[model samples]
Target: MTLSPLVFAALIFALVVSISYAVLVRWLPDPGKERLAQLTPGRGSDHSTLWSRLQKRLLAWLLWLSPWTAAMSGGDEETPSALRVRFGHAAWRSPVALQIYFTCKTLLTLVLPLIAWALVEISPWHPQGLQRFLPLLVGAAVGYYLPDWILSILVSRRQRALLHAFPDALDLLRVCVQAGLGLDAAIERVGREIRQARPELSDEFALTGMALRAGSSRAQALRQLSVRIGLKDINALVSMLIQADRFGTSVSESLQVHSDALRTQRRLRAEEAAAKLPVKLLIPLIFCVFPSLLTVLLGPVVVTLARQLIKPVG
Candidate 1:
């Protein structure tokens, strides 16, 4: 149960950081708290229920460099950055998400090299010349991009889920629209009906419904939905919906057509994946399966030839 000096030192460092955070939160004025309170959305700020929020406020304030860094970079400060949009697509629509991401990226890039260096120092293995800094540099690079990698994974998983669940949503929406429901009502009803079956798409539909209810125009809400989902098929569906809504077209018929198109897209995606199967298996076939097969097939022939040649020589 004994901790190594390295582990002990890490633990002490963490403890000191935590204590510093606690003291800083206790005394220093918090702008993060003020910002959160402004956007509190009518939640009562009772101290008992706000302990977790209180804890995060100071941390967000302490991680203020991210926004400043973004500001220093050249771009429209008003419009959301591409990184922010990616985070939104990943279903992390929180105001503090980008801030937290930047903070983690900065910390990891700075801390991992030091950690690697410490380990190198404590360990018996000594890396000479450029080899000494290689691990540290690699660690720093990995740490810096680690958050991006995670966000990409989350976005990919969420998008895959959305794609698989989308055709179901479309079918339901078409059914609802044909069943004497208005488009908005159809969407809301579809959202409710599909909630149990496909919650990812269900949530998107539900949010779109909410946005419509909250005074956003149909086109705007649908556009936002398409952007957030970031699937070609979904974007197409959004365009179709917007056009249908604008031109006073038959939504039921449009839904039917779009459903067919989306299904075709899904099938094509499946077929494309199937087509690539051999390509994906190529490496394993060559390195693993083919070698074993050659060994089994050629071993006896090679041994027989060797025995004949050796017998003749004797």
Candidate 2:
């Protein structure tokens, strides 16, 4: 088959575009480096410690890749060392890792368009040569940022999963405390008990426990937990815990009450969604189902009427 000029041009353009995308990907920051930098202690006894050395190597490799990352990650604003230290606790490990892991997914936005183009090119149904450029352009644009968009979706899903498990975690904590464990012991117990069912929450709880054991205050650990999840429910729970601690209230009672409230709120949310189901269904019924029903029910009558009316007119 003789190759057309337009097809030849598109193939060349795709090659150049793919190369540019690869360069852009190489220039993006490695999330693992940012994570390590945030988690590393600023100054310590051993600057040559194994983890510290590893972090340094990672940072060096990351910085080597993109000179822009240093600029993008942070600017000249001088945050206190103490304040920067707190950021590690606030960052949700999953979301950051999520963004890094799926950054390459953006390339998929090109797949459908490329496939369609190839199909049209080979098949007898091929359109005029000039029309082929449109799909390729749209595909490239969509594919270029698909990864970033997918990462956001993943973050949302992870957040929802955390929220779903939170009430159970609170209930477990309440039970542990009611069984005579102290607040710290109760938190540890809850973390251990819910490890399988609510691993994310369990991990956060365990981290809080670790921080507490490492000499941080209970309030500080709880605050960190709230920040890490970045969830309103976690914030409310932390606020309640803080108040209970300050006011000498029963911790178990406080947890139990919060758990009950969370459960109630979840139930109410489910009911609200169920109530909206009919409204949500209406559009589909009008556009799809209703039309199909009318076609099926009235189709024969219309055909018969057309035949009778036409014979009389003829």
Candidate 3:
């Protein structure tokens, strides 16, 4: 029942490849994430999705595997408010998201190093001590930070979607306000109106309206919205709304001004990105494309010149 070195190496390669593919899939932002969040009710564990169920099972297994891992798995400690707020910005406010995230991190952090160590033990290199542990350490580092990287990516994408939706929302709010609905009513109406088109932004507005109805002050609720979103535009909009309300200024006019400003900023961002495109492309243009083109066009010429300059003794 012993495996040969070749078999062991093959197993290691297969394990690494499979794990990498799984991580790639796991890291991708789910398109149906918001929809799932909306439909899946109840607390902590979201039994509605396959991924969530998998996370729950994995967590249970981790807690059973090594009791000490509880701290690493986030099972023993209370979820941090900062992490919760960060997830909210990523449109993953459910308790299940926190569970899934920490579970994945713990699983990968523990699994990867073990796999790396097994490979190193069988590896032919045979580094004495410190060098042998290098790969394992590298694997551990990547595993620990992978979830954080994925979360940031999710936050960026959700922010982009919300940013695009903001101007339309401002217009709707302006219309609602000018039509004499109070600012609170306007938000609720806009939330309902945009639910079909911009569901994520709509959800935030709906929550803000609910908070206001639940006796939270206008400033407090608006600030909460800005916090959850963690977007500068929303933060500015919240501050503007609060100031307009506090000073008894016309809300409609403020909304109109802010809406125009958002549009202008969006255009400027596009132009700035376009301006940077050539500079960004230069690296690949020089390193990747030029080398290949030079090889194709000048490789034969160089070979010919070398042959001519150093003729073989005949």
Q: Rate the local accuracy (lDDT) of all candidates.
A: 0.81, 0.71, 0.84
Q: What's the candidate order when arranged by decreasing TM-score?
A: 3, 1, 2
Candidate 1 clash pair list: none
What are the per-residue Cα lDDT tens digits for candidate 2 across 52-82?
A: 5776776455444434333333433642443
TM-score of 3: 0.75
Worst 10 residues of 3 by lDDT: 42-51
Clashing residue pairs found in predicted model 3:
none
**Could you tell me the lDDT of residue 76 within candidate 3?**
27
- lDDT (10s digit) by residue, model 3, range 172-274: 9999999999999999999999998999999999999999999999999999999999988888989999999999999999999999999899899999999
Candidate 2 weakest lDDT stretch, 10 residues: 95-104
Q: In model 1, which regions exceed 4 Å deviation? A: 1-80, 122-125, 293-314
Output the better candidate (2/3) by TM-score: 3
Candidate 2: where are CA atoms >4 Å away? 1-145, 312-314
lDDT of candidate 2 at residue 73, scale 0 to 100: 33
